[model samples]
Target: MDTRDTACPPTDSAPVQPKDFIRLIVEEDNRTGRWDGRVHTRFPPEPNGYLHLGHAKSICLNFGLAREYGGKCNLRFDDTNPLKESDEYVQSIQRDVTWMGFNWDGMYYASDYFEQLYQFAEQLILKGKAYVDSQTAEEIRTARGTLTEPGVNSPWRDRSVEENLDLFRRMRAGEFPDGAHVLRAKIDMAHPNIVMRDPTMYRIRHTPHHRTGNAWCIYPLYDYTHCISDSLEGITHSLCTLEFENNRALYDWVLDELDAYHPQQTEFARLNLTYTVLSKRRLIQLVEEGHVDGWDDPRLPTLSGVRRRGVPAAALRSFCEKIGLARCDNMVDIALLDHCIREELNATAPRAMAVLKPLKVTITNYPEEQVEWFDFPWHPEKPEMGTRPLPFSRTLWIEQDDFREDAPRKWFRLAPGKEVRLRYAYYITCTEVVKDDAGNVVELKCTYDPETKGGWSKDGRKVKGTLHWLSAAHAKTAEARLYDRLFLEENPMDKKRHGKEFLECLNPESLHILPSIFIEPALAEAAPGFVCQFERLAYFCVDTRHSAPGAPVFNRTATLKDSWAKTERAGLAGEG
Candidate 1:
């Protein structure tokens, strides 16, 4: 199936004021003097992997809400897991967020609060609210019973407060080996919420941290560290995905026990797109298994990948706004994303002529050494965009797909004995078809009608088809990459239902590279990252990483036709 045809059709209703449950809650909080009417939020991401579309939504929401309320938002790195976190991921995250046109008021790392976090842990032990557990990892998991049954109390749950404090301090001092002992909150073992059943507050990890190298051997777990970080920063609202809804109980318990400044936590549905997997684990696997080029491979859904593929940041922001915030999760059709990209590019991208699969055509009747410069508008409707000079001569190149020796019944494009307009030039008729030794039609000999200058017949004759072409003498060679959906299945991660491995659902033809493409000479000077529409082809961008000064490599962004619009039109026609 062509997944390109799959789309979540947009409604025709007029735009309404943006109001979601989270917004309503924020309004109520302001009315009730929550956090003293100060609005502060943070985008806390773990620096373990590059940010993806899912993170983009959170970034927009956190930053967007803060901006809407005239508040401040901080960029915080949840660098607690040093084993997997690195400086590369940190730099990429900052670059991605900045590229999305957001500036944080402050930047921080969770490791910066390690000293205070340890002090808070000691405070828990002294208050008899937390204790050091000597049980193995498996033992703790086994004791944390199923949803239907109460968990069993740990054998070391009754340790003396002084002993627990000494053990925790020793753990911090690097006197204990990894996993020898862990600090757990002294919450009820029989609590209905599993996350509150003596959750681990700190664990011994001898690994060196990227930011704070060899500073401490003990590290605070995410659940314990996140709340303290939020409270320490005086955040008014802690926004997170719905998976952490149960963890909210534990978050509240830690803050309440320590009597720290509390922040209200709100959960919203995360972005889940069809035919794509946003899980960091799955993405990492794809990279490690060589299923993709890298984190920024245009095929992957990573923000870097999407950016490298020439998706404008404005388009992404507009898409997030259109999707809005919802309480329940749903699979967003990838076509909507394509629609957003096409809609944005259609208004802004300049027009250029490119032949992906070139077929040579010789104007037999035109003068041999003559070269006419025809003016073409950069954007037809947008006259202010101006125009560029297009060279027309005896020899030219047209798209191979634009010609057919044995034409179909209503075909209007170039064929034997057929006359068509050469875009802004005169009308031309194919006089003879040139073939190679293997009978492959390699070229066409055409005769031009000089009376029909500038593509309009002076004698009131009508031409049904117009084709974009470039003077062979003035055209430049380029490399064009045609990219498509990375995954073939609508839900690549549906292993149980589909009975197929995620890798098995990978689309073999996701990327097609055309090494010998021709474009107009005006585009030869096009700099890296310059985007334009390739006439009858797709919207493309000059590859920033590969393009040189005099040569440009283009990456296909999206096709001109909107598949989602087609689907919608088909549905409406059926209803009629």
Candidate 2:
């Protein structure tokens, strides 16, 4: 479990007429005294897998509305499908919602209302509103007509109420095999909306549920279980994504038939983020087939994945606010999300130095056995964050990419005979470059000026470049996992648009691991979930999943900015 404690950063106060349509509805409902001015919403997630980024938008909206209005929101698991659900997924959902910084007024499960939901189904049957269907699952799908056609009614649609009751009871008694029969609402066969064409309410499954162990053999479908559970809890508003717009009619049909308390089912467009896939089926395939690591892989879009990648809860909330709510679905640029993360981390994370690719530099003029300590501020702009002691010595490690043997006119970094300021230490001039047998730059020999003690000269001499380095003898070795976007295309899920399967569009270079790296000794003791900036590099966090007492693994959350964006601005060709 993550040890970081967080709160849902407070949203700005609501206005006279709210900007978004959903808020507008809530405002009008309050003014009209709907449900006696009580506002209640619920986040009902199916516990078949872990929550992903798409679900974050819904979680924020549902819980945020209740919070702003001083109402209540419930965290309910729609665990109707026992075959794919498990306790692991249920626990993960709870942890994620909490990590996102919101607590539920009440926690619940669809299984808790099984008896009441079953009774409601019987009530509909007694009123000639639903019946038992004997068709196979495929046959039922075939009969459910398309946009231009009418569906063929099931032969068992008109079964006597007494007979249907007996069959349904038998289903609960474990008298039928899986897929033997399904209980469906007897809606119009010729309805224009295909979802209303006699949808299934319950199906027989002999599998034991994670919660309600083998005492029964039947399970209710999601569409049927969701609305009834909301009504039973007296929810005033049932918020769902736009994909459920067509299902709204059926949601109302079930409650209206039972004469139960009905919550208005409002649908808004779901978040469609770029450069990754969020569909449950695709995510499951990615995990099950070993296309990625686990559910919490930083490259994945799952909330656990992003959290492990060092995305703060406050930044996610801010991103949600910037995007707001929309009636129509559109792709949101992932860059906006990166911007929010950078904004939050830059203000809070302390500054540190790390070398992903180390190249040794021996200061020829400095005493080999001597060591000095330099005072480095934790943050340049935030003086209150204070300072830490960093060791300076004769031998140190700098980034391999920082030095160029044949430097360009625009390059200010290290090169043969080039002088550069060592950050927080002294000025060094590279006099020699040593190469390995393969002609790779192995080491650099440099000389430091005694007068330039604190990275500056007593005389008014200026250096164009400054480089970050760590004392070779004092620095601790650790691993750095550099992570990037998981997909190459903006809309990876659009198979036709990409001319390949979604999996084929996956980014092969999403993750590059540097097995060994050097960081200042203080960073080795950083607690899991601690975030900081690697000066001149990127924003990183001590991985909560891998770091322990003395071992730390850092995950790069984002570069100073996208590498390409920086390259375009600098008008340079290679790494500097």
Candidate 3:
């Protein structure tokens, strides 16, 4: 039995709520008895690079649709180009999809159907539908004319079917060197859609495929391979991004001419995120040029990058659902993505205290050997999560930014002679600030109000500022990496219009590593990928790659402030 025959029903038991346009189309298809009320979709990603946030949208749509309609979604790798494709990328893509809480009904690769694809090319030639073109790539491009002008036919277009067949077989049998000849469809050169103007069906590439090895010297192009793969896999709804809208004509033409099982191709706008570059070519450039550490650099929009940056897979799925499907393209605010992460983390993440820039504070009146343990709730509103023991001692570590010698008008944080409530502890009044030879504030001398236990004053006198602190004796030293937008401009590629390279727009302050940050002792044994919120700081996760036993390295996920929420509030206020 086919493994794909075993269908896993949708996890949600609620009645189908067809909200998006894509879902609505599926609904209508089911209503009209299209393909006998069966729905099958596939996420066919080319394994040239790691999957990105943009790919997440397609994955959700395809798998979500399959689940919603009681069908199956196949995970297929469009591994046509061996030059840039690799098994490492294939594994990464699979890991990403699985991490996003999905399992493919069937797994396949375009290379798996190489023999069939070659035979199909011969079938096209026998029907006078395809021919071998000896023209160089540039010659073909020049002949393929502008959008307004019709393309000119290749001089080799009139090759007999026997000659075309022999060349195509030889091309596949490793007889021809790379780029010596290509198989082009014998479609109308004067076609309105430039993509249909005799598109190249196959090309000779001597590079060994990660899966197929050097068994074949020639490979079918994506335009030629994708449609056939879908048909062979019995895909009912072929969903892809709008960039392939032009190519859909060729998709249909090839299958129609060959009398193959043609699936309906639908196009939706691909995700274009603000403060991000999703183009695979640009992403490759970023990786090769060392703009990022690798494909998984937290600054990049790649799925592995975001995953490493501590973004929950659930948050990514929620973002995709919220963005929905649209026919036209638009730039989605990265803040919106951040909003989703913050929302999910705020509710689920355990709270701990971490001081990124530590400033020492000594409680002069407190006994040096005396230690008090206070129970602090993991989440203020979630008592079910219980609490962790927080140690309070004579000395504590506070955020350097929390202290201001020359305070602003509205500054309520620590200042000389000011009283502030330590989170879940007593109120403390700063007596004096100690500085080093360089005159930098090194330590603060403070006296705690013994009566103000549990951050509440018995006399009902309230302190204006509340600050987070860690007991110096019990705190664990850690490395905290803070990440910001990778690109300085909202549209990094837009710099090209202004005669500046996109690299020029790379943000210099994208990553900041503080090696000696202090966190609660409870976080010392935190395993890699463990996510938590640092009180008054940011949501963070143990770095999977760098964090180790006893010493944990944390990556700043997102800030507490929701810029997207603020934007929505401001828009509402403006309307009012």
User: Relative to the true structure, how large is the alpha-carbon lDDT of every model?
Assistant: 0.91, 0.90, 0.91
| lDDT (Cα) of model 3 | 0.91
Worst 10 residues of 2 by lDDT: 1-10
lDDT score of residue 461 within candidate 1 = 97
lDDT of 3 by residue, 502-537 (tens): 888888999999999998989999999999999888
CA deviation > 4 Å runs, candidate 2: 1-18, 562-576
Misplaced by over 4 Å in model 3 are 1-18, 496-498
Tens digits of per-residue lDDT, candidate 2, 359-443, equal: 9999988999999999999999999999999999999999999999999998999999999999989999999999999999888
What is the clash count of model 2? 0
Q: Against the true structure, what is each candidate's TM-score?
A: 0.95, 0.94, 0.95
Q: lDDT, candidate 2, residue 34?
A: 87
How well is each residue in 89-112 modelled by candidate 1, as lDDT tens digits? 999999999999899999999999
